[model samples]
Structure formats: structure tokens, C-alpha cells
Target: MQKKMIKKIRKRDTKGLDYVINNYSKKVYYLVDKIIGFYGREEVEECVSDVFYELWENIDQFDEKRGEFSSFIYMKTKYKALDYKRRLEKKEVHKTELEDDITNKITTEHIVLDKESSEEIIEIINNFKEPDKTYFYNRYFMYYKVDDIAVMYKTTRASVENRLYRCRLKIKEMLEGRK
Candidate 1:
């Protein structure tokens, strides 16, 4: 049934896709607004729109057996919103050097492959231990970025970068071993 739905979507089944978009767009908008706020409303709105485009483009990748599609969409929108927020916060820094510092600090070193690989990557992220895992989720998963994570958790951007580095390396190693 899920496969058939995915096939229908991939076949340019506008009605099927519309069913998804209509069912999910409100939730996406609410989450985006809640997380990104109006201070930088344009960026948030743009990112929310991007998330929907991504959802439509990648709809066939979804696997209902693993989890509910709505949860996946929620998480993706949340991350995109966070990324928007992170970019806006960095814009507040003003200095070119500071912007560079922020960019390097929160960079995501991971590459998402096909659905199976993405699922594996998510599983590895889920395996992280407290504080480190939560911090990581807040940073990358939420798109908090390094500087924002530092401010939110009362730490330094350098420290957050180090955490991200370690987390990335750890996940990389885990994924490599799984291959």
C-alpha cells in the first residue's frame, strides 16, 4: 500500500500529492513559525517553502513501516527552521570574520545518501548518549548552528564546533563500520 502510494506520487499524481501537501502544509507552517519567529520572517517562510518542495521531491523515499510520514515531515521542517534561525543569528554578527567563524563552527560534515543510508545515519544519531546527543540534536537536527547552540547552552562557539566535529567523526566511523 505504501509502495503503491509512493508510485502514484512519483507518477505525477497531483491529487495524491495534493492530499499530502494539504494534510501536512499547516503543520509545517506552524512549526516553521514557532521555531523561526517573525524577526526574520522572509527567511523562515522561504525555508518552509523549501521544506515542502523537498517533501514533494522526495516523497517516494518515505517508508511508512519505519515511522509515520507526518513525524518525518515535522522533523525535516524543524531542522530547516532551525537552519534559517541559525543563518539569521549569524547575520546579526556583522563582522566578516565572525561570519566565517560561525559558518565553520556548525557545518554539517555528513552526506545523506539514499533512503537506506539516511535511515542508517538517523539511527546512528539516535544512538548518541545524553548531553552530547541532545546537544548534537539541538545543534544539527534543530539547525541551531554552533553560535546559537553556544548561546542557548551557555558555552563557547569553539566548544560547540568541537562537539560537532567529534559527533560527526563518531557517526562517520559508525556508518563506515556498518558498511
Candidate 2:
């Protein structure tokens, strides 16, 4: 089945693309979702479509002797998903900085917190343990979601969430004691 589709794709028959997408959309989607679940549904759908586009464009590179077409598609989907995630991260960082600058300029008269409290909060965050500190910085400072952190740490989303919850409670207790 894949050989026939490959042949058609090599011949530039559009139906070959259709056949591959129809047959493997779910698998591609699964890979994309696993890699970039922090992205919205539309973004994930766009990534899946980008995977198909990649496969279509690189049809000639698909050597049957190297491996299966399914494997090639899976690899391409994973790479594309990671690439998309990196691009989003870079863009988000710039966007956040720009927004912060604008907000600071607009709110000069309405500072959200005094300098001392902000410094204390930073100290608290810096004092957190290894992976927990990293997780907290990624989730709060860098604005990463639980799913993104899970992928980064190679752990489950539930585990990340539970750890974050416990960390938050601990921080709350510490802050309450300080007051």
C-alpha cells in the first residue's frame, strides 16, 4: 500500500498526497499532539498540515531501502513539531518582553508590587530545589504550560502538575510564616 502511494507521489500524482494523508493523519496528529500539546488545537492542526506538506515536498528523499514510509513520516512529524515549538518559544519571548516594556511605560504610576516584595519573591524562587526550581522558572517565569514542562522533563503531565501544586502550597506556607 505504501509502495503504491510512494510510486504515485514520486510520479507527482496529487492523489498520492491525499492517500498518505487519509491513511496517516491520525498517526501524524498523535505525534504532533504528543510533542506540542501546549499549543492550541488550531496550532496543532497547522503543525499536522505542515507535516504533510513536508512529506509531500520531500517525497524523493523517501528511500524504501533506508526504512518504511511510516517511519519517515513519523520522524518528519516529530522534527517539524519540535521546530514549531522552538519558533513559538522565540516569538513568545520577544512578544512578552515587548508587552512588558509597553505595560511598564503605561503603568509607571501604578506599580503592581513594591521593590522589596519582588526581591523577596525572587529570592524564594531561587531557593527552590533543583528540578523543582527549574520547573517553577519554566512554568511561571517563562510561561510554559504543564504539558510543555512534561515534555521538557520527560515526565507525565499529571506528575508535573502535582509537583507544581505541592510547590505552590509550600511557598504559600513559607510566605504565611514570614508574615
Candidate 3:
């Protein structure tokens, strides 16, 4: 059955994917729910969608010689669900400097300011060149995941994070100088 589904999937047959989804979605949902269930049904559903998409996109990397197809599905679903859970937790989890500073200041002091100050900060970030401008706006304003931002810039996650950190420090310094 796995061989048949694999062949159909490899051929880009939607029916093959549908078959896999029909067979595997419940199990995927069960696993994802067990991990990220507290976030509610919407998260569980999205994780299931992502798991299937990943399997379809990365089917070539799956080696039967390495493991069972069921195991592959299980592991993929598990990790994807965990990632979703982590993202959800991070959104509401803690109050770190990155979350506070350059967000909506520097170090322990949040540069509380009026509307003008906010505009000034926006202008400061906009003046940055190329990727820095893009990175800062996305990271600070759009709340994009660093990993997703890295993919957009064709760079590593560490690199994106490093750039964002530097941008934050620069902004912090600039804001301080204004005081």
C-alpha cells in the first residue's frame, strides 16, 4: 500500500495525496492535538495541513531502507506539532528584552514615548539599507518568525537573528542619543 501510494504521489497524482490524507490525517490530527491541543482546534487543524504539505514536498527524502512509512509520518507530525506549539507558547510565554525593547527600548528601560517618538523610530528603521530595513520591519512590526524571515532572505536562521539583534542594539543606541 505504501509502495502504491508512493508511486502515485511521485507521479504528482492528487488522488495519491488524497489517499494518503484519508489514511493518515486522523493519526496526524491525533498526534498534533496531543501536542498542541490546548491552543484549540484551529491550531490542530493547521498543523495537520502543514504535516501533509511537508510530506508531499519532501517525499523524495524519505528512504524506506531507513524506516517505515508510518514511522516517517509519525515523526513528521510530531515535530511539526511541536513547532506549532512552540510558536504559540512563545507568543504568550514570556516578557523578554526582544519582546519589550524595540517593540512597541533598550535593556531594562522601555523607551516610553508619545506618537512623535514612535514615528521617529519608524523613520529610523526605514532609513536602514536593504536587508536590515527589511529584517527590522518584519521582525519588529510584522512579528514574523525568524526562521521564515531567513528563508525569505536566503540566509541562515542564525544570520537573520544576528542581524535583528544588531539592528535592535543600533536602534537602542539611537533612541538613547535622542534623550
Candidate 4:
């Protein structure tokens, strides 16, 4: 069935493309969800459509001697999802840098913690465990939102918020103990 569809697609038959989409959209959606579930449904759907577009555009690249049609589509979906993820990451990085610049300007004018206290806080953050340290650095030092951190770690926003809360409590206790 798939091979016939692939052949027809290679022949520029639109029906074959429709048939492939009808038969394989669910599997493609599942793969996209697994790779980029942190994104909204609209974005995931867009990625699915992009996968089909890629398959349509590169139909000639499919070689029967190399592998099955399903494998080809699966690889295409994975790569497209990864590409989307990379694009989002780059956008987030640029946005973060710009926001940090503006924020630092405002914060430097208002905030006045002593250098010793700032050093102590940095030391405390450095001692945190794997993802807690990463979460703290991303949230406080890098100024990322909880949603972005959740997406970056492929976890829920609530989980990121809870962990950050716990880390903050620990830092508070450590600081209070010093005083």
C-alpha cells in the first residue's frame, strides 16, 4: 500500500499524497508529540503539515533498496521536529539576551545588595543539584520564564515552579542561618 502510494507520489499524483497523509497522519502526530510536546497543539499540527510538505518536496530522494516508506517518513518527522525545536531555542536565546539587557539596566538602578551577599547567593546556587542548579541559573541568572524552563527540560510548568520554590526556600534558610 505504502510503496504504491510512494510510487504515485513520485509520479506527482496528488491522490497518493492524500492517501499517505490519511493513512499516516496519526503516526506522524505521535512522533511529533513525543519530540516536541511542550509546544502548543497548533505548532505541533504545523510541524505535521511541514513533515508532509517535506515528503512531497523530497519524494525523489526515497530509495526502495535502502529502506521502507514508513522509515523514511519517520526519519523526516523526527528531523523536522528537531529543526523546529532548534529554531525556537535560537529565538528564545535572542529574546532572552535583549530582555536581560533592559532588565539589567533597570535592576542595577534600583537593587542594592552588598557584594558579599551577592557572592554568598551565587555560591549557594552553585551547590544545588543537577536540574535544580540548572533551573536556578535559567530562572534567576538567565531570566527565563517557568514555561520556557519546562519546555527546555521537557517537563510540566507546575513541576518547574514547585522545584524552584523548594530551591528558594532552601536558599532562604541557608541565608537566614548565616545571619
Candidate 5:
């Protein structure tokens, strides 16, 4: 049934498409909100709709056995939110400061993982909830410094640093276990 639905959607069968959309719309919206947070209710709605359009556009590329459907949708929303964040950064008038920050972070902290290792790192990080995952991504992938992460997370720099240090150690352990 799942394969048939996917096939129908790929063939442009409207009814099958509608069935999938109707079933998955709320899940997609919740997933997007989880990734991007509540900017505003309307923006949240649009982001979810954007995810669906992306999913529909690329539905044929989905591989069922590789991941859960929810995970696939979550990843799609996550990438979209990251792209939106980059767009906002590009629009900033304070580009020099941003560039300087990027330079400083790159010169300071190291990215410990290669491509395959990074995926394993993500799997470990996904085990965290709420502010933990948010904090980890902001600190590492987005390269926000401890002070910046503290401001965003409304915590002290020491606390943010501790969480990041532990999260990194946890990810390293998880990757080691995979060996």
C-alpha cells in the first residue's frame, strides 16, 4: 500500500497525492516548527507548506527502507530552515561582522568529523530533545560562539559551554561504539 501510494504520487494521481497530504500535513507542520521554532504562526504554516511542495517535487527520490517517513520529512524541513537562515544572513547589512565571526570560529574550533562520521554524529545528537539539540546545532553547525549561544538560549556562557562539551563527547562516544 505504501509503495502503491508512492507510485501513484509519482504518476501524478491527484487522489493518492491528496491522501498522502491529508495524512501527513499536521506531522509536517509540527516537524517544521520543531526545527525552526515559532517565528510567527503564519511563517510556521508557510514553512510547512514549503516542505510539502519540496516533498512533492522530490517524492520520487525517496527511498522507503533507508529511513522512517517522519525522519525524511524532518530532514527536509531541517534543510529548508537552514537555507532560510542562510538567506537571512545574506541580507544582513552587517556582513563584515558576520564574516569576521565566521573567520574567528573557523580558526578556533575544529570540526571533528568527516562526512560519514558527521552522519553518525547527527544520529547521536538526534537522541537529544528541545534545547539540547537546538543548542548543539547552534553551537556547532551554525558556528555560534559560546557567548552567542548563551544569548540565544538565554543561559550563561559557562552553561552553554558545558552542554556543548558534553554533547561533543557524547557524539564521539557514539561514533566510537559504531566501530
Candidate 6:
């Protein structure tokens, strides 16, 4: 039955898709839920649906030489669920970043005079060398608390502040055409 279904689906038969989904959706849903159940029922349902769609799209990658077709489907479902889990984790981190009051205050109070300069300055800081870039961000962008950064980097609090200050000052001078 599995071989017949795979053959029909491989031939682009829609009923074969229905057969596979009917037979396999339970296993797929169980795996997705187990991996990312914390994302809530709605996301779990959506992940199950996406897994089926991916199984259909990637049917050609199945290799009889390697393993059974059901194993292939389950593996794909596992990877898709893991991918969803990673994306959700990143969303939480970004949400935390946005909720940082100091970051918001710095973002508002220091706009670099205009949108274009703001973009350019951001570009410049992103390209700054090594720990300087990280230090600049520790002080300004990420709200790392200078004391905490000094401890983490194994440096004096004043040293952290001064390096960060020089980085900021370079951007300031460049923006003012003083460089």
C-alpha cells in the first residue's frame, strides 16, 4: 500500500497525496507537538500542516536505498518542527531587545540628526573592528550595563567606557563632517 501510494504521488496523482496525509498525519502531528508544543496549539497545528505540504513538495528527495518512505516523511517533519522552534526562539530574543527600555531611550534620544545619517552610522558601527563593535554595542545598543561588560570582558569599567566613547565619538565626528 505504501509503495502504491508513493508511486501514485510520484506520478503527481492528487489522491495519492490524500492517502499519504490520511495515513501519516497522526505521526507528523505528534512529532511536531512534542518538539514545539510550547509554541501553543495553533502553531502546532500550523506546523503539522506545513509538514504535510513540505512532504509533498520534497517527494523527489526520498531514497529507497537509504530507508523507508515513512521514515523520510517523519524526518522531514522533525526538521521542519525544529526549524519552527528556532524561529520562535529568535522572535523571543528580538522581542526582548525591543522591550529593553534603555535601548528604546537611546534609539529615540540619539537619532544621528536624520534618517540617512542614522542608517549610515548604524552601518559604520556594525562594521567596526572586533571588541570595539561589541563594546560600542555593550554600552549603547544592547544596554549591557558598563559594569557587567567590564566584568565580562575582564577590563576596568572606565576602560570599557572610554573605548565605547571613542567609537561613539568617531561616529559623531564623521556625521558632523569633522573627520
| Per-model CA lDDT versus the true structure | 0.73, 0.80, 0.81, 0.84, 0.71, 0.82
Q: Which scores greater on lDDT, model 1 or model 5?
A: 1
Q: For residues 1-179, could you state the per-residue lDDT of candidate 5 as single tens digits?
A: 66777788788786766777787887777766765553557767777778878877898678888987667767888888767556645656357556855664553334443335556566778898767798888876886776788887688977876776677677656665766
Q: What C-alpha lDDT does candidate 2 achieve relative to the native structure?
A: 0.80
Q: What does candidate 1 score on TM?
A: 0.47
Candidate 4, pairs of clashing residues: none
lDDT of 3 by residue, 1-179 (tens): 87999888878887878998999888889999999999899989988999999989888878989999889989999999989988988876454535744453334125434324577677778888879999877876687877789999899988987887787677777887886
Candidate 2 residue pairs in backbone clash: none
Residue-wise C-alpha lDDT for candidate 6, range 1-179, written one tens digit per residue = 88888888889898989998889898998999999999899989999999888877878898889999889999999999999999999998767746664564464447565545567887879888978999887766677777789899998978886787678667766666832
How do all the candidates rank in terms of lDDT, highest first? 4, 6, 3, 2, 1, 5
Q: How many steric overlaps are in each model, in order?
A: 0, 0, 1, 0, 0, 0
Error of 4 at 172 (Å): 24
Give Cα distance to truth, residue 54, candidate 3, Å. Answer: 0.5
Better of 3 and 4 by lDDT: 4
TM-score of 3: 0.53
- State which candidate has the highest lDDT: 4
Error of 5 at 17 (Å): 2.4
- Residue 6 error, candidate 5, Å: 0.7
Q: For model 6, what is the alpha-carbon lDDT of residue 141?
A: 65
Candidate number with the higher TM-score (2 or 3) = 2
Positional deviation of residue 116's Cα in model 5 after best superposition, in angstroms: 68
Please give the ranking of all candidate structures by TM-score, highest first, separated by commas: 6, 2, 4, 3, 1, 5
How does candidate 1 score on lDDT? 0.73
Write down the worst ten-residue block by lDDT for model 2: 107-116
User: Stretches of candidate 6 above 4 Å error?
Assistant: 102-179
lDDT of 1 at 47: 83
**What TM-score would you give candidate 2 relative to the actual structure?**
0.59
Worst 10 contiguous positions by lDDT, candidate 5: 107-116
How accurate locally is residue 105 in candidate 2, as Cα lDDT from 0 to 100? 33
Give the clashing pairs for model 6. Answer: none
Q: Name model 1 segments beyond 4 Å from true.
A: 1-5, 95-179
Q: Write the per-residue lDDT of candidate 1 for residues 48-96, one digit (tens) a residue.
A: 7899778778886777888987787898898888888887777776566
